[model samples]
Target: METPSSDASAPSPWADAERIVLGRDARGGAVAVALDRGGEHGRRPLSSTELPVWVSAREAEGAATGRGIRWVWSSTAAWYSALLGAGVRVSRAHDLRLCHAVLRDAVPSASALREATAWDGAPAEAGPSAGALFELDDLSGNGAAGSRRPGRDGVAETVAELLRQDAAVAQAAHPGRMRLLLAAESAGALAAAEMRAAGVPWDAEHHDRILRDALGDRRAGGAPARMTRLAAEVREALGDPALSIDSPPRLLRALQRAGIRVESTSKWELGEIEHPAIAPLLEYKRLARLLTANGWAWLDEWVRDGRFRPVYIPGGVVTGRWASSGGGALQLPRQLRGALRADPGWRIVAADVAQLEPRVLAAMARDERMAEAARGRDLYEGIVAAGAVRTRAEAKIAVLGAMYGATTGDSGRLVPRLRRVFPDAMALVDAAARTGEEGGVVTTWLGRTSPPPDDAWRAAQARASRSGASPADETRALRIGRDRGRFTRNYVVQGTAAEWALAWLADVRLRLTRLAPVDSGEGAPRSGPAFARRAHLAFFLHDEVIVHAPAEHADAAAEALREAAEAAGRLLFGAFPIDFPLDLRISDSAAKD
Candidate 1:
């Protein structure tokens, strides 16, 4: 339902599906047919219907030059869109012939798909749905409610408390700690307040119940459960009532000393290996060293006004994203969230997006079966219902590969079944794969296109295609061309998915802006609170986001998350047969290890 635009002036097929059945074949390129409604001036499907056509710039120019329209430039789907939009009456009688004609011609030479000495046609294993080709607005935070005034020395109080708290000191040693934490806290508070201000209908208890239901299967025997146990141990070791967790080094050290071997593997790729304690350990330590030596001093100087406000980078990732500053907020070390603490009067409300990418994939593919599989329960289990090969792990592997481009082992074996069950989604990604391997430019749903292929590669393709080359030699050159094509093919979907994320973030920010502040009056500053206390988006890594808030508005923030998901769905795909849902979790800390 999230339709990509062929041209800015043209409406999307889904948006105009009622008017026509858009379609194409290789020969005629893009084509459309008007729908026939019962009664009235009905135009029945006719092979000889005089269809008036409008062509793109190239096609128009070709007509003027007396050269037949090439048809190779447009895709079958794109052509089909043209047909539907053109108002031709189409039916089953003409489906296959019309479709084949458009597709056969548009299909590149066999060289585009076959592997050869010069190159390969096969698409690279997909990456987690990522690529960028869309516009995204920045996250907003313009100070606390009713006034643009900065909060009184509240940042100082929080920082001071952080300084006194030994565990906080260890974690805050990282650069941008104060700023990032403050931003997160501010965002959370603002979300809570916004619900009160707007008087939106929300059920905090129901939200909590949903989260619990979602998490029920999470604790089943798995790496996740082990990680939880490790976390509890770290909290106990820290001996801080505040439950502050330092970044990775401290956590890793604690786990290592306790003799817990933390292992990780990239399931999508074969031979992907990680030592039990090395990879994540090194990652955590590297950040700690950088932040400790460089970021803290800068934070101290920047927050002189009692406010350590940081910019919120909305949709920063190849996908829709948001990032933060001052605290290296976006680069939060896993297991380090407990380091975030509020002042005496305030409590933390932390929330994150769950199963976001998969859900989006389901809706975008228009896989009602998959959507229903995800309905009312865990999406992983939904895959099980969809008939993924054995175990939840296998199901997860297949679903992820389908999104990211894993084409080996279980992932490869599983992808076929997923495609069989979800052809629309499969076809969408397949088109992307085809486009990239062919070295064509890839674009997102909103028209953001990838940079064209490198000149050297293009030159090689030309050289290989020359009339002088032997058939064998020519095959090699075409293969190279196809590899480049695969890259672009994957690029389109990944990039557009990111765009969708950004749009969703922007919508959430706009809605949250209308909310009012929560007044606990418990720590209610008599002279006004410190910091530029706004509901701030503090962290983002790909699809996930972290928002900080005051305890009073935690429920409201949760509700806003649901609203944001719905609004985003409407914005991208419109109300459809399928519903796009977001998995959400709210806690007092930012821990997802």
Candidate 2:
């Protein structure tokens, strides 16, 4: 359904000129204005009832022809959620809030927009429901002055910010890279809103069954049967019948009294102590975590209409990785993957890049040796075969040490050996670490600048440098410096990996849009109208994505997932011979890790 001009690898030329701003009209009603060659056309007001219909018409029009319109909106969550609720989908958007955050830190020259009002605040999430209609009252005179959301402002303020953003990109040090980052970030916002609207195809029954098996039968106003049994076993082993297993401090004290001396009740620490209570206590803690994090209460709250919607905040992490404001979507346990079921007549295509961070680092450093070690399906195995290490396990340790700045155990000892083999890759991370240790900042491959040291950190360094500073102050300073160094060492790799994932997600979203919608009976109504039986990205983590598609188009969906991976690699590092192989699967359930 997309024309040749709709390639997602590069930024659009005409989209910059053909701006469609969605904001309030004069008297306080929502409107879509057209801007061309730097001038705005008259506003076309959209009523609450007519808003989704008009947007769907325009969006469908763009998808039909080769030419597409890039929607300039205040925030993706503020507007796109309502659009998706009505089953309308837009191709691309210029999320002013998301873009402003990027430019504020990355581009110092763009001070005008950075100093602008309401553009630097927290993103436009925490709004009303996606299913609720956005009326005139929400977009009227209560804009930046009252709500501090530029999207709520009248036509003039909104357009002014958009133009300022245009200027920001023009003055960027690497405008091309900045443009790609902004586009990828904005596309991520679109995908987040869409994913929340569509949600993961969830099976409430499967979730309950899993809960029953792991946690035992639910009890009214009490712990599960299996949990109670485990708690009893733990108490008996500790020789304290009145032991409060839920309280960590009390449990730790009980363990100490029973001769199992440990710092905490953590599984890792408890496992080292050869005490009978350790095993049952560990099992109890595991079950308790599950009950508290994703129990019956969670299922009742998150899962709705056969879907689990999660609120994603794009660029929430300083490293440009996505974070969840609610729903704990990124931390779902492996045991519950089976609960992420596809709807009837549909299949789930799941895929994740293998050794994503290492591959990204190889490309960024332009290290041919490292790239050769990462050319195959398993980067660790390839590293072993290249004689970097004797075994795959050792190779993994060295590579992880290089990226994460581990300098203490086997990682510390093996990293030097890796340094000799992959000098370029090691040098890149080493430079970042040194910069961070000196209170300097580092930028990712896509121009995402790392945050500098905080006031407390600088004060510690200052104390250490003073004439009368004691050994304590100097020791504290050295410790904190190493900590910051480790952070920056991984920040570059993780941030670029996030950018690559965003590109992959955006391309997959665009590709899925091109697939024809299936018949009416096969539609997943809970997923909204925009994503019917056709393939649609239902869930996304930092390095993985799960597409929900009709059974008939499963193969096509799988191909789209693979092609999007290749496109993302090229988009980030053109002609860089680095592979991002996926452990892909076509399954009825997400149980396969």
Candidate 3:
């Protein structure tokens, strides 16, 4: 923070800085203030050009490596994207927007920090580059990118909110745990932005080939060849050549006319009925979904210059799971994984933790029995070996039943046996379900609380308990309660699993940053200069990560994934005996050798 100035004896403000808050100054330009361990440093003008250079120098000097200057921003989604585009990678950040949402519900002490601020809303998308836009044209006041990004807080407001959040964390019941959750959530925001900038290494050609193989040729303004044939077959079987097979109501009526006697055209329901139309109808739905979701048009829109830049919305889900606004990053089908091809001299190190939620559940419940069952192997198989179930299939159903609050059929039958064996784990979810049934709240392992029952739900319960309530009213109330119970039963586990995933992602990001950058041409230039030559995380689903790296660094990246998983486990659930085993491999493409 110090320039070549009068006092030669003094040390630089950023030498041992705690954090840096980025916000708009009164002059409508960007300002950065360094927070020293002692107190706040004075505000200084930071332009789009100088900010990255100073940050790059700090990184080069290795000052921000450990417990370093965490960049405090109004919204990471609005800010970090441009930073990545500018080739400046920030090591750590405190995303006020994301943290505000987490605290407003989870930490009761932090409720005053709520008060419906702009930070509570969905984050603004990353706008045009500041260096290119604002630096060239002073259209908006702030010199930073996304100066016109709606709902952004200015310098004074940003610092005030940060202080409020810090105080909220300080007053929380478990301050350390609250702080860890905030850090993890913020790290997730940063990673999401960076991943968008980096994008998934994609091969447009392979994507096209896969599309053609499954959907046939890309017919202009019409259904693909395969889809057309299937639609015709479906129409012929229904004895209605003009039937709109895509229209569910019309298709249902047509099936009824053909004497199928089915309530719905769902594959599951239709598969139960033996009919000529069933086979072709099911095939049509499958291909149509694929074609609509990831067909030729998808390739044209998403894939660009060997990368598929999906817009990632971190913390988008109520359970804290990430949702994709664009390229379906969370739902990339296994069929198109072959399109995830690395560059010529680089490779893909893909690793997904096996049964992450169950493992997290065991740790949360501290269920030694379940932990022992999962020691160094598949939990379902371990259940069978432990004599709790006859087969892995039974174990899976029972475990899923426990988490999802299943109450009938095979799941209901098998759940009791699991409850008897792993009482602690089952009890944890069962209590959460009961809380949900009574309109109470349940919290994740790291303290993310489930949202309370809505007013409609509360009204239904109240009505059902009233003196004038009838059997139908009570039945409706009970059904809704059960639905909520099911939701909360899964929420605690899913949310905590998300927390674990965030920790994993943050750790992997840091580890990847520390690795040696390779000497190569601009292989994935869209990844930005900061990451173009180094091993970088290219894709992330909830429990899986794919790191694109140099061939020589593939082993190192794989090792980082393993180490990061273990580190994340300990970071969240210290001294827990649970382990996160990964089904990992290194390859040129997502295709099998």
The most accurate candidate by TM-score is 3
TM-score per candidate: 0.48, 0.92, 0.93
What would the per-residue lDDT of candidate 3 be over residues 1-593, giving only the tens digit for each residue?
A: 34433332234656556888777654446666677656566456666666666666655444534556688887787777766767888888998888988888877766557653555677667542232111123322334322233322567666766777887888776888889999999998888888888888899999999989998999999999999999999999889999998899999999999998989888889889888889989999999989888888888898888889899888889999999899887887889999999988889999999999999999999999999999999999999987889999999999999999999999999999998999999999999999999899888887888899998889999999999999999998999999999999999999999999999999999999888888766565656776788999888899998999988899999999999999999999999899999988999987644
Scanning candidate 2 in windows of ten residues, the lowest lDDT window is 1-10
Expressed as tens digits, the lDDT of each residue in 1-593 for candidate 1 is: 32323342243322222223222222222233332223112111212123233323323343345542312111121122223333221111111111222122222232211111111111111110111111112112122212212111122121212122222223332323322222222232232222212211122333233333322223333323333444455456434333323544555445445455544212222124343433443433343344443233433543332223343333233322344434454554443344343333343444444565666666766767777777777777877877756678887888777766777898889989888877877787777767665666555554444556677677776777787877766676666666665555455566555555555554566554445655445542211232123343434445554554455655666677678767766766666444445556566444444
Report how far residue 117 has shifted in candidate 2, in Å: 4.5
List the lowest-lDDT window of 10 residues for candidate 3: 128-137
lDDT of 2 by residue, 120-192 (tens): 7665553322221222333333343234343344555667678888888888878899999999999999999
For residue 345, model 3's alpha carbon misses the true position, in angstroms, by 0.6
Which is the winner by TM-score between candidate 1 and candidate 3?
Answer: 3
Query: Which residue pairs does candidate 2 place in steric collision?
Result: none
Q: State the TM-score for model 2.
A: 0.92
Residue 488's lDDT in candidate 2:
94
